[model samples]
Target: MNYQLSLTVAICFGLLVLLGYFLPDFDLLILLRAEILRWAAILSGVAMFVGIISLLKVHFNKFMDQKSNWGYSLVLVLTFLITFGAGVFSFIFPQAEGLVDFMFRYVQVPVESTLAALLAVLLLVAGMRMVRYRRDWTTWLFLAISLIMLIGLVTIEAPIPDVFPFLRDWLLTVPVVAGARGILIGLALGAIITGLRIFTGADQPYGE
Candidate 1:
């Protein structure tokens, strides 16, 4: 009985939202949709805050307990505190904007750049390992494509023919765009399927 009521409520709200989107002439639906969406946004923000607090608590406990690798957790806690403190100060006193910007540039930017570099290095190492073990055309092709892309990224003119640069541009513009669109299409289809499942009661959320 409770499950049926929950399913009925879900279907009603789902229809209200879909109708509000498709039929903007219905003022009541538009208002209901706006209120529902606003509540969702508020809930999302609260959830995010809870998650951050939970993360800090976990790391603080790990550090205080003096577990293995506690030093890393200590570093993380200190970094978070410093960053958060700086952000709060900057927000309270607009004159301290420079302090926030400095931390972002010196700390965050370098960390992100290092991660990106590690990703490239890891990918190269993985490709080499695959080629060594497999010794197949596909592995060789993968390595060749990676090399060509890296060479294309260089601003300096290489000793090789001009065709490499053209090939790189074509690959970026054509295959990359096509692949990105395909991923978006897949995501949209998945979302649609999920909505249908919810509406049809195939996926029950409020069940005990």
Candidate 2:
């Protein structure tokens, strides 16, 4: 019975998806496409909720055992609960409460910014150490680019000749932006393919 139901649903979905592409003249196909997208969003939200539940469970266990770094888990749980409560109350009240917004703006933002700054420092230190150890052309190139980027971002005015700021702008706009965009596109495509594969029963992670 389960097999038959699954097969039927798959067949129907495939036919509707194909129809939307093949018969671009039909308005009903467009509606079907929208419906498909709506359901996809709903399912994705549910999946995200499931993931959060799993993460909370793991962290709660760690906290209960008083594991090393359990303080971080405590912070995580506290933050999650506070944010959840704020969201629920915000929904009920419909007015932006000062305390909730303050917590979100001051507490959350500073913590996030501090963490980001720490990571950036760690990355820079690691890169410097690598350059010290390897002293290869690749490491040299990485250090050069990183330093140029840091300088460009920090300096109010370009240190180089007027033409050099233009050059730096070009390098940042062209290569840096293009590489970042390409990586993002590749990651998004990979995620979509993996999701579809799982949905189609081609990749099973649950050992079914």
Best by lDDT: 1
Lowest-lDDT window of 10 residues in candidate 1?
152-161
lDDT of 1 by residue, 144-167 (tens): 878888887788765877888898
Instruction: Please list the C-alpha lDDT of all candidates, in the order they appear.
Output: 0.89, 0.80
**Could you give candidate 2's per-residue lDDT for residues 45-136 as a string of tens digits?**
99999999999998999999999999999988988998889878877887766658888789879988999889978987898799779987
Give the clashing pairs for model 1.
none
Q: Which one wins on TM-score? A: 1
C-alpha TM-score for every candidate: 0.73, 0.66
Model 1 stretches astray by more than 4 angstroms? 1-9, 83-106, 132-137, 150-155, 169-184, 205-207
